[model samples]
Target: MVIFGVVQIIFSQIPDLHEVWWLSIVAAVMSFSYSSIGLGLGIGKAVEKHADYGSLKGVGIRDVFHDADKTWSVFQALGNIAFAYSFSMVLIEIQDTIKSPPAENKTMKKATTIGVAVTTLFYLSVGCVGYAAFGDNAPGNLLTGFGFYNPFWLVDIANICIVIHLVGAYQVFSQPLFAFVEEWCSSKWRNSNFINKQYTVKLPGYGPLELTLFRLLWRTCFVIFTTLVSMILPFFNDIMGILGALAFFPLTVYFPIQMYIVQHKVKPWSRKWLILHLLSTVCFIVSLAALVGSVAGVVARLQQNYKPFKTTY
Candidate 1:
């Protein structure tokens, strides 16, 4: 994912999304293929009842409530949900990628609806089928649960697809972050050659660099910093939990509704305004709880002296 972030930064430098939209399509297709495969495998396993594998042996809805001390489970689940549905963060940017004025909003709305519906259905099907196949013994990652002994080729294909999809996804999501940082730096260094139009600098080792040193410095540093952090704290679930809790509500729920209310000039005490505010308040509360729970989980894991890349089980 971190490597993908760097790839995203590089691709984001391209001025037009239309030029690179094919990559996104390819990623989407790959994701759909892998997810479908996973669901298919789960269903097949459930039906086959292979002797070595305990297929359908423990098939039932797993108990939801865990020990009180294991609050991390709840938070982790919330994080996963938030992460899955968090595409709202990049919706506006995606919409901007479309050409034209009148139909863009409608098209974007339709696309978003379809995307969400399909993603939700896929997730639900995969989760249910995997649960039916493995019951309480399912691994955190569905792919990981399918060990090397059984149909290893499918696992390999799924993993490869995941890698390809993430490469594109990282670029799609990280572009906005890169743009924001670049804009900020441009504003701060107004006189710099990088921000100035028609300004180029010549270097001894390399021929004329188009932008100033600041651009390369900041962008490279940002990628390096994120990469290092990812390496140091490679707990995917925990990190996803933290990010989702911290970002999902504000980015996905609160800001969009708030912006709409403000744009429409809704009366402060009006029903629409009141309802939106109430919804935002609820999201805020949930976000707070998730943040606290995730933080506690991280601290607990740290206290255990958990090492990255090491399997606990």
Candidate 2:
């Protein structure tokens, strides 16, 4: 995690999301690398070993809490799924990076369609195959779970790909946040040199570049703050579940549907309105359940003597 923070600190200095287009490409490649490896390993295990391993009712209680009933695990699984698909929350920010000979929104829509389809395929394949391979004993983490221990070097490569992918994913999600805060602060303190000033410096081979004292300090502090938070609540999947549950409903579903209704000026009690509201309500219920389950998972972990900075890898 410290290594993650350090890498983030360096890339977070890149100033803008568009500046890290190469990073995005690299991260996407790393994502495919690991996903393919995981999917391939699972397929190999299923074909070579017990081809018929899983039960129809899903795996036993081995995901996080072995003693808890299936309901909590199923609810927590909802949150995990939400987290996996929550990358759409960053789509608007990402869309701003597109080059525009074609209409940007049109391009974004097409790209999003492809991206979602591809990700869904990969995620479902990797997940179902892994479950089939290990049956009731599948670990929460695929590559890092040491489930594919025989191919140590390949597993190692997949893990490394995960690390690289996360490094870029962190910045992809964070740069917009940094921008928001910096823009707000600059506007709030319009004439303050410390807040609004940009400094130009020449790098050894990179030539002149602009820097800001406030950005340097504020972004660094922000990274440190989030790093500390991660260390404190190191329940990776549970934390993801919590964040996913919190962000999924409003960001991913509700707001867009509401905007569409308003833009189209749909009648308040029409079929469209009724359908949209019904969908929103259902999503809200799912999100609420996921949040509760994930929180329970965290509480359960805490009861098992988990401590900050003391958890063994």
Candidate 3:
């Protein structure tokens, strides 16, 4: 993850998503391949009646609601799922990459519909097959559960694909944050040549350079900071749950609906206004619950003295 973060920071210098569009395609293909491999292996194991299969024999829909004595786990799971579906946070930024007359709304709607449909199918296949293969003992990451001695090469391939996909995905998600920070810095250092796009910095021993030292420095620092945090708190699931809860409602549910209500001039007491507000309120409650659940989970883990930089599986 740290390596990927550094790679993302370097690639973010490109400044235009369209120029790196092929990266997204490659990442998508790698991600799909990885998921497909996981599903196939899981189903194969189940069908072959591997030793683990007996554990899953009684699994059913009811198992989905079981929480292993952790009442708040369901909320954290919901938060993770919500975060997975919350691309609205970056939708507009993605649309801006399209050529004008943008037709951005129409294009974005079509893209989102297709993306969600495909992602849903993949998630369902992997989740169901994995659970069927290992029951309540299913590993948080399917790849990790596969021992190194069995199908070692295949496991390596799947893990590699995941790394490649995450490399691109990190860039896609981090670009917005990079842009936000850069804009703020530029605004603050208005008199700097770096902010003026002329990059006039020169050294006594070297010729003038077009490089923006401040931009490079800040972006590098940001990547280092994130890398340090990842190293310090490497609990992937817990971190995902926390981030999901913190971001889901505000980014995925609230802001979009609020913007639509305002844009359409939906009046109070009207059907649209009432419906929108109702949905927002429900999301708000869910977000709060998820937040509490995630915090509690983290605290419990800490109390247990869980080791950092170690794989939970």
Worst 10 residues of 2 by lDDT: 60-69
Question: What residue runs in model 1 are displaced by over 4 Å at the alpha carbon?
Answer: 1-19, 50-66, 194-212, 308-313
Tens-digit lDDT string for candidate 1 (196-300): 444366766545545445555666677677777777676677777788888889888888898998899999999988999999998788777777777766666
Our tally of clashes for model 3 stands at 0
Q: Which candidate is the best by TM-score?
A: 2
Model 2 residue 295 distance off true place after TM-score fit, in angstroms: 0.8
Tell me the tens digit of each residue's lDDT in model 3 across 1-313.
Answer: 6667768676655554565677878888999999988887887777764536534244344554444425566666676677785567667788888775648778888889999999999888887787777776777688776774367888889999999897777777777776787788788988877554645555555445444766677767877888778877766666787888888889888888988988888888898888889999998898888877777667666666667766342
Q: What is the TM-score of each candidate against the true structure?
A: 0.82, 0.94, 0.85
In model 2, what lDDT does residue 185 have?
Answer: 96
Best by lDDT: 2
**Candidate 1 clashing pairs, residues 3+ apart or interchain:** none
Stretches of model 3 off by over 4 angstroms after superposition: 16-18, 51-69, 100-102, 148-150, 197-210, 307-313
- How big is the positional error of residue 156 in model 2, measured in Å on the Cα after superposition? 0.9
lDDT of each: 0.73, 0.86, 0.74
